[model samples]
Target: MRFRKFTSSFDTEDRLSITIDDIARPLSSIQSSFEGGKVPSEFVAPLTKFAERYGGGSFSSLFAEGKSARQKQKLVEEFGSVLYSMETEEVKNEETFLIWRDACRDIIDWGLKVDFMLDHLKQAARDFFGYMLRPSGSESSCREIIQMEEAISQLRKKLLHLEQKLGEAREDLHLRLGDDISSDSMSCILGSSWVPQSRASRGLY
Candidate 1:
């Protein structure tokens, strides 16, 4: 039996409406900045590494694992640190700095989009449970509800598995990026207050 019928009430259709174009624009802008010599020469190597690994050499590849918010957020933090460091240089080349700065902002924007998509999914899950709890009068409805319960249980298992994988990925990212780039520095560069907030605290993961 199709589970889509049961999930239809959760308004998830728009969640799936995120187009490749929406994801590609920022990535393409970053690439263009690199190619046009807008990014500083010192940053090119590390930025290239960051793009290939996190961006998968293309925006579409970044979302290949299904709009993972954790992955996107990690990318933002890593690259935002690099961008912030670049901006701290004493050189007064405003044009080049602006180009690079916009590219960094684009990365954050891309990450926020992923976060928004995940939020939609979480809300949809909540709505599904709420809808399922409503009283039903018919035998057919009851049977469908039973099927939905089973489906939701399986979904919970899958979500847990994904969460575990995400945790592993986070550890891997930390190992690859190293400890030299501090969160406090990134937060200062991004103009955001830094505090230790676990994944659970943020309602993400």
Candidate 2:
């Protein structure tokens, strides 16, 4: 099938309809790393290793550089090809798939990175509270701990609200993808690879 653009329109309660482009941009520039010999062409491995040994020990740091960004894009491209080759059985139930689903929140959080973002504030508050409350007899600091606990509670409420909003957005996107097709479309998409439960009784498996 020929590729084509897909777009959607939705009236969010916030009165904004956001359109995300399908085409991905290069992660960063890749020239300085090549010039400085700081990156290797081992483009198919997980980038965490490359960053640890060469690109300053942090994926975020590598992402901050233009040259490292290009390399990252290349790495992602290669990784995506590997993903396409995987059997559905291997990916559909994997921990990696679940992490990407969970990490969608972090991805969206980074996109907004706004001042007064409650989810971000909540993460900071929880981190601070954990670090501060670890001392012996820290329970004596009840007044301060109470305030932090209140802030964290409020943050949890806000995060739940935002999660509901994101869920609605995803539902809208799913609806817009197209009316749900019949099992024929599903069979065509899955090819003759696996027998459906309904057909397996007929020795199709």
Query: Which prediction has the highest TM-score against the true structure?
Result: 1
Best by lDDT: 1
Lowest-scoring 10 consecutive residues by lDDT in candidate 2?
1-10
In model 2, which regions exceed 4 Å deviation? 1-140, 179-205
lDDT of each: 0.48, 0.40
Each prediction's TM-score against the native? 0.23, 0.21
Q: Which pairs of residues collide in model 2?
A: 28-69, 28-70, 29-66, 29-67, 30-67
Error of 1 at 150 (Å): 0.9
Candidate 1 residues 1-205, lDDT tens each? Answer: 2234434533332222332233322322252245223543444565566457656763344443454656654554445344444434343322232333344444546553233333333454454554555577675787898999999999999999999998898667667768786887545645744467634446343
> Candidate 1: how many backbone clashes?
0
Residue 18: error of model 1 in Å? 68
With candidate 1 superimposed using the best TM-score fit, by how many Å does residue 27's alpha carbon deviate from the native?
A: 81
